[model samples]
Target: MSQTLKQPRNSTERAGFRVDLQGLRALAVLLVMCYHIWFSKVSGGVDIFLMLSAFFLTSSTARRIARGQRPPLVDGWLHRFSRLIPQAAVVIIGVVIAAWIILPSTRWLELIDQSSASLFYWQNWYLSDHQVDYYAFNTASASPLQHFWSLSVQGQIFILWPLVLAGSALIWKKFFSRHNFAWVAGSAFGAIFIGSLAFSIYITATNQQVAYFHTGARLWEFALGSLLALALPWLSSLPEKIRRFGGWAGLLTVIGSGAVLDVQGQFPGFMALVPTVAAALVIAAPAPRSWTNPSGLLSLSPLVKLGDLSYGMYLWHWPLLVFYLEVSGKQKASFLAGTVLILVSIAASWCATKFIEKPAIAWQASASFSRLIPQSGFKLIAQFAAVAVGLGVASLPVMAWENNVEHRRAMAAAQTATDNPGANATEGWDPSPTSLVLPLATELDSEWQTPGEVCEGAAAPDDERIRFCEQGGTFDGGAPDLVLLGDSHMQHWSAAASAMIEEAGGSWILVYEPGCRYGSDADRVKETCSDFQDAAQDYVADLAPEMVLTTASKTVARPDAMLRSPGEQEILVDNYEAMIQPLLDAGSRVIAMRDTPRYSYSIPECVDSNKDNFANCDGSVGYALNSVNPVEKFLDSRDYGDQVVSLDMTGLLCPEGVCKAVIGNVLTYLDDSHLSKTFVLSAKNQFASSFKEATNWE
Candidate 1:
């Protein structure tokens, strides 16, 4: 997960080769690579690497403190980063270029953001902020740079761990004798271990997706490693046979962990102890002299050499795998293909180690020819800064190109409504052909619609479950007050609704959650969805808006299958009726818009690739939607009277039974399910007419 460091010697021994540690590093990196490539599981190897990084850092710093010498904090940081940044910069640059060349344009903007985050060692924080689920099965669209999150975490700890050690050393020198430094350091790390572990457990239980990338949740692994380093001498004094048994047991436990444990879902928490403790056992036990022993096998020259290249290998493998999948259009790599990838990765890593990493490691920043270039820590840090700056400067052109593409997309989106009729093209209006698609593939990431401002005053929902509440359009006296409520499906209709409301001199409020449905009572729906439904119902009742809008059905589709089952349609209609009963009671007419068709592929990417013949990307409306609106069937079956109305816009969305990706030269769906804001804006006229008819609002 990070660059391996030379372990410090015990008090009785001189600093020398640590073959066992080298082999351990090799094994850990191998596990990480295997799990990522072949198994698609968390091997817990990165956890082991984190522990080892802290172990080496603590042992070296503690020894320096005990020897009556100040910890070389500036020199230590510069040296560590100088070694890490150059090699990482090489991989980052490679991934950037490869992504531009091989990956879909839909992924380019995200790559730019993730690449920048990775270069600056803040990738974990970026991922945590996005709430990315590391274990999600979307490998085809997965970021090649995701593996950098572990390295970023280690890079952060490399800076913080030393400062903590120095502070502890300062405390010990000020208050206690040098002999008590171990106890002082142990107490500090033990507290961190306990606190971080408790926090990790709680966060993992509550929000495992975010907890997986959160750096604070992982600090305990490093603390545990530091604790083990402080206890190494005591551990080495155990009986030789016992040490050997511990070593073998630790190795087996580590090897079997991914297979036996629910590692993807239950890791970096209490379950993480399984691998970190196993690593500690291996580190604590001395290398066995016998070839048959776990330590002896680990001490092999081939494994040691692999360990030397581990950091580079770790950096190279993931991006290579990602690019391979992208180019080949495979969900997972075949064994033969994976083998070729690994071999190429090993070769690339060797080149990086030989040409970039090893040279940087050997470069003496302090070696100066004259007085102008003084031998100082500043020079060393400057050298590291130069590498980062060079990488940043190199990325400038790519960023500029992305900006240019986005600018073009904006200009295209702002063209006359007639130029990009979108759904209105379904009305048999002939549209002129244009070379460019409105809201280009590069612009898809920003296509989701949002209200003008956060909902405030009495309009805002008091319930915490209604985390997202926003309003747009004029709220002037005598204007129609409308509320749009539900999940993202309802939210996507905001562009057309806002345009219609603004033109009519009215205001609209949007209460939305990404995945939560309005009336979902399915056992699989998160508890938050139920709470949000309750909050939305109360908010609608309190506001008593003239009309409330929500999605009345759900789309069910797969790449190979597109139709929803009859039972599924019935369930959705039932959920909708229960949801709107409250709104009807509150004198708010429910304008239930039929849900948009969901596709099994990226609409933008499909349109981008098939620009010359985008009709190839079109789907059958009958397959993407029900033969009849399920909500209307439910309405007719019962007598909800005039309060409940079904507003089916499938005619505008999928004209002549076809759901097109690009209609009237404008991109429709943002991805597979959501509508692009530009396309929705094009539908404003039709949407307004439909709204007036449904609500009987002047």
Candidate 2:
């Protein structure tokens, strides 16, 4: 995670070079590579790297401060990043080029975005925002740059840690004697460790997905290293026998933690102590007493060499493995294949370290360039600036290509009504064929529907279960109010529903949770889903709007079959009736929309890959949906007396018994199951007509 492969020789010389730590670095990267390639799981290795990086950094900076020198804030950043960035930029540019050649067009824009994020050291935050599951084993679909997350976290802390130490130094200078600097610094790091650890535990329990990539949550690992560095001198004074035992024990634990623990599921929290503390032990252990000692094994020459290439190897291995999986179409690499990957990664790492990282460092240290720049700090800054500029220049072609795709998507979306007739194509409206499809594969992120603005004041629901609320049209008291309630299936219908409602002199309020359906059976739902469903029912009852929109059934698609299960359909209908009873009592009409057909594959990705023969992506409506609407059965079984209605738009979605990926040049579904905004907007007229008939609206 950290560029700790080669610490500055000056620091190592002053500190009495810890050859064992170098070997530890080699072991850590090896664990990471093995686990990622063969096991598709996280090894505690990156956490160890993070700790080691902090240890080296804090030890060097504390020494400087103790000698009354400034913390070298700007120069350190310039020097560290200048060494790190060039290698990272090379890997990022290489991944971008490889992705463009090997990955599908649907993944291109995301690859570009993640590439920029990786280069700028914000890839962790980007992945967190997207809710990427780091533990998931879908290597072919995984981002080639995903491993850069740990590096990104390290980069951010590198910038922040120096400032933290500088502030502590200033506090010591102002409020205490110079001798108390260690105490002040220790206190600062301890506070960070305590506070970040507490936050990590809390967030991990609530949402481990976000906690994994959260910078604040991972800060404690660095702080632990900082604290250990401050105590290393005292620790080294321990008996050699104890140090030897600790070294062997720590090494064993570090190697075994990933195999024995659910590291991917529980990390950066209490569980992270295993590898991090073991790494601390390794760092604190004394040098080998003899060739057979625990420290002696780590100090071997081969490990030291591998450690020298560790940083570049960490950068190279993941992308190569991801590309390998993609190119080979395998879920995982065999042992031989994985070994080849490692060897190739090591070769690439050596080339990068020798050709790029060493040259940059050499140039920065060159006497001639130093003489020209004179001031060491300015020279460092200029070196870093050159690296940044080089990376930015390398990224320009990818950015330009992304912009062109965006421009084309905009043009395609704008022409949906004219060139892409969508549902109207089923109604005998023959539109001219167009080369592009609406909601281009690159634009799938924008396929989800949204209202004009977030709901507020009277329109907003008071309940916490209303995770997201948005309103369309003026909230003037005179406008007819309608509420759209359900999971993402119901949410995707909002574009056409909101447009139709606003055009009818009404306003729409949407209350939604992505995977939580409104009327699912309580026993069958997660606690969160059950709570949200109850809250949604209460909100709808209290508002008593003219109509409530909710999905009436759930459909799932598999390779062998695509249909709603009979048992699930019956339970859903029963739950729907119970849910609507409150709305009926409040004198509100209920319009239950039949769930859209689901597909086994991503519709847009299929369309993108099979542009020549679109039929390859098409599905049978008879298989994807019920022969008769499930909601009709619910209506016939109930005696609600015209209070409940069923709205089935399956005809428009899957015209003439076929659910085509592209309907009239407008892509229908964003992925397998959700309708695209562009396609829904194109079908607004038909949707509006269906809504009016169901509600008997004027």
Candidate 3:
């Protein structure tokens, strides 16, 4: 239910005749829908759509060049975008309203950003930078507007394809004035197809996830369609028998390819040739060469009618599917529900095409809508103004609505904790610190002191010039005596650590790096991590504290990528011992606490949506721990004697083997892996009691 690709671009319109391409459009859309709804497989429908768009685009440009009326680049670009964006605008506005009503507030920021990216034609690039998981759908949430990535790609190409045609027109005027521009254009596109196909095959093999959404990686599909537009005239000369066989073969191949091909890493490569060529064969089949054209079956009324609405259908289906999944709380829709969704999408598509798209296109093409005045020279300016004004007007309300909602929530949260005098002494076990009331999600942190103290992403020089900076201390009539260390996992616990240091009448030193787990005998560390670890060793040796506290395990790695076998676990334990044993040797007691449990989805959003009984977000400790915490499992399974203190804090977070996102009316974790500072500060007394028992201090 995540995505479907369709091609109802009206491809045959450029020839000034209905070549029955609408039938192909109907077929392509149905293939995409069935694959997305039920099969959980890609049908090569997106590749075919890419080809069809190029096919029509090249045909129209060639016809103009053939008649010596070269396509005006800016005007063509305006019309192309105008044809597409209105329907897309309607869908985006609808999704914005639905998101505000149904989706959790935590998702609002990302959804708003995606809506902006969709309005502009950069969603594909945005998704690429984010490293979106296009292949899988998690149980908790799916981006309702994720399908806009394809539309963004198409829009970018629509703008650029005209420039390509313009280039061909330049070549025709300069070098080959005698020959028709078709040959010159065909030869140029032919070379492009060869080069881009090679690039596509290489990148797809190397990184399919990135290449899947990358415009450069899929340009070859468009190039092939451009070349086919020129070649179709020559191909039309084939006899009736051969053309009939090819038409049938192409139709059958389009229907059957999805059933056989597994398009994981193998797409947009040579495998994508199946659908692109099938669609080309259907386009090139000569219907007028014979009386009984079996391909005439495409001229049927119902299929043509569906094709008329295919673009709108593609836009409408995915958000509906995603919203249904959100409201119904089902990962995949039941058969009955999916059928109902399909029917509703069809109805919506009909309305969008009939009432919105057709009328908008007609109006935009009118003399008044397209010209600043009755004058001729200002048409481009007029087109720009109209498209810009139309989109600006459509999107501003959505922007204002989300902003108002966020402002109200923030204002309400700001009203808590007016006094700021003292902690509540008589609350339940592990209560949130009542001294300073927190926002619902506790999004801000006062004790955060990691990246600003150190140049987080900077690499160390070959020679040492202060490799890392150290920060965090309190000198309230007492000497500094505590030093905390490790990756972000250790960093997030600063709230509890700060409270403990204050109670013990001392200050603190915090040495941390992002994602740089303190490892010694494992895979190679980044240069910065290795340098930080060395500097940390020297600092601890120079100013040895009473105790060195650090996290010994992490749950940030995905389950598939983690090492879980006993042999792998032993290596992790070896790395942990090697990393922390130096502090213990430096005349400082070291406590390596068992890392906290992780969640598969964001905890705050789940709690926000299910607020009536937030316990519905309880995840089993097994899933909470998952595969990445085996180092803790290995450390806890055996004895390392008294040199290293191995403290287990899992039970305080996960009582009775269930790790709920909420406890004591405050969210336990802000996100998937990190505990919120507010929640940790809430547990200050518990942390004091545990530290005292483990170290026999105070």
Candidate 4:
């Protein structure tokens, strides 16, 4: 019970029943900040936020339904959109512009595509396709919009919740209710909350990262808050002492959960209940009659201020941290620098709320943007125009850049130079090692850094590659031909090799591992690798292909984790033998291409920073070769002769034993390993020659 939050009209009685609900808002924001900044122990803040969202939405909707009128669905949706869009749009546009200024072509286009997808609320699907693990270190992904997954989940909930609540209220009134909908709704809501929480716990224990990030598993926290709002009336009647005790208990629960819970293991399941229930208790607590209430602590000016800006603060902070780290090339700094970032983010948020959000919302509510008519009105036209223009803007860049000749050439050259060994030994290595290279402060792509297109018979899809292959058919023409089976890395060569196969009149069968490894024997790729291998084996058995083309062993597919050091070629050779034994037994020759070199630093990151000078990107091919495993030990021990030819990329990919990201005018690889779609298209000639030599394609 907070006395400071309760005001007495006269000396005789406490006039207001205020429990300082807004004060709890401050605590919620602090919990979030602490979790993001340093503490990973608790997820109390997200739960608190979820509870608040549910309570506020339910309370507002209940009031509307009680008035015998349906809730304004469009208005409610617009209100949410108005509140969120301004700051979000600003951040997105800011990221895009920043990316345009500093990022390399290989990175810029992909980030642009991702950002566009994210803005349209398609980020989750895109991430799933990219296999972007949400729980993985943030450094692994370069997208500023990755954090928006939570926002998307919240939006999804807002879309469905109001309608369900309204529909339920109407049903109850016509059937069981004696004109009382709140209690019925509350009871039904409680059931739903409990069920969802149970499901969350089950899913979290089974697969926590997906459960934690997914909306279905998290909706129960919000439902719990709505339930608390329904019970608040009964709680208000309790004695002051009891209310005070409840308040203290609630505060402790929130703080304690924040201090104890960790997001690393099982989370947002049963663990989330601690914070949700605590927040509910705080909201339900009665007002104090004297100066003894502890709620005042949260109501302090600074905390309240932070609470007010919490929404915008959440949106701006992560991107700022990302950009700062990108520019500085450093990890998070001391408290002072972080505090400054928070303050700056808060200030920026305030400005965004003032100039963009408030104005947009106010204007939208006015008669100008409002549609009195349901359809075929000026408002509808305006909405159509906005959508059309946004789509047009997004599509134009993709169209324009996809056809650029120089860009295409650069991309092709990069693919050939980075993935296949050619006559040019120094094709992709940076020449001037002693020259100083300044890190670019912005993320932009120039024409010189673009890639070609996806390989021809490759499963890789691009604007240019249009041919589709059925699972059982011959790719180019006949049996005793070539068959390429692998992941995206394998798909990268379709254009080049498929053309040669067509010319040679030999069939090229292609089967790509979607979320699977290429090798048949690697058990670590248990997800889909085994299935892919089974399919390939069946295909190879049916087709009786003369040669099977695949890449070096995947790092993940390695049997042991200690293979990171030099001179491990034998371990890799063992991995290859395991993948090839079945193919050999089936009377097919297996040719293994050496894996492409990864930049010494993160590829997309360097591309994001526009690091043209390759010092950071330079890595030793010998090290990459050594990464193969115990070389001599395996080679001497094995009898699989001329059948196993290493199509080493070092001839074109590295010079003087060093591999680099940039060569002459072209960016080497699109990402760390996969050749860019555009680059793959350009490399057709070189790749064709290699395939001919490896399998006698012509």
Off by over 4 Å in 1: 5-15, 132-140, 178-180, 365-368, 371-435, 452-467, 470-481, 506-508, 538-545, 559-572, 585-588, 635-643, 693-697
User: What is candidate 4's TM-score against the reference?
Assistant: 0.72
RMSD of each: 4.1, 4.1, 6.5, 8.3
State the lDDT of candidate 2 residue by residue for 425-507, as single tens digits.
65566665555777777777777888568877777789986777888875676323788888888889999999998887778
Q: Candidates 2 and 3: which is better by lDDT?
A: 2
Task: Report the C-alpha lDDT of model 3 over 271-305, residue by residue, as the tens digit.
Answer: 88988898788777776523355357776767777
| Stronger candidate by TM-score (2 vs 4) | 2
Q: Cα lDDT of all candidates, in order?
A: 0.78, 0.82, 0.68, 0.58
Measured on C-alpha atoms, candidate 4 has an lDDT of 0.58
Model 1 agreement with the true structure over 1-698: per-residue lDDT tens digits:
43463321131155444677878887888888888888877798888888999988888888888888988777788767767777788887878778777776777777788888887789998878775532122334679999889888998998899889988888888887646788988989999999999999999999897888889999999999999989888888998778777888999998888889888798788999999899888876766546656778887878877777788778888998888887788878888988888788779978987887665554554344457655674567566574666467547755775676677767776677677666656566765565467777776656788856998766767788789888887776432378888888888889888878877778889998778778777622687777888888887887888888888777755532445453244224347777788888888888877778888787888886776788989988867777767777777898877787888888777878888788888888888788988888888888889888877877
Per-prediction TM-score, please? 0.88, 0.87, 0.78, 0.72
Top candidate on TM-score is 1
Scored by lDDT, model 2 comes in at 0.82
> What is the descending lDDT order?
2, 1, 3, 4
lDDT of 4 by residue, 1-698 (tens): 00111111231233332335555665666566556555423456766776777777787688778787787566566555545555667777766666555445445546665666656655544554454431122235456666666666667767777776877787877896675777778877877888888889998888775676677787787788778766777777888787777777888888777667675466777877777777777766655424355466655656655555667777777677667666676655347767877788788878866776556544443435445664335444444443344445545554454344245455444453334322232535543433212111112132112122333443333322223232222444446467776665566665565666666655566656644555646453564566556656555655556878776544331223664533243245235666677887777777776555543355445644555444676666766555443333344577877665555545556667776555443445555555444444455666776666755545
Q: What TM-score does candidate 1 get on C-alpha atoms?
A: 0.88
User: What value does the lDDT take at residue 117 in candidate 4?
Assistant: 69
Instruction: Report the C-alpha displacement of residue 164, candidate 3, in angstroms.
Output: 1.7
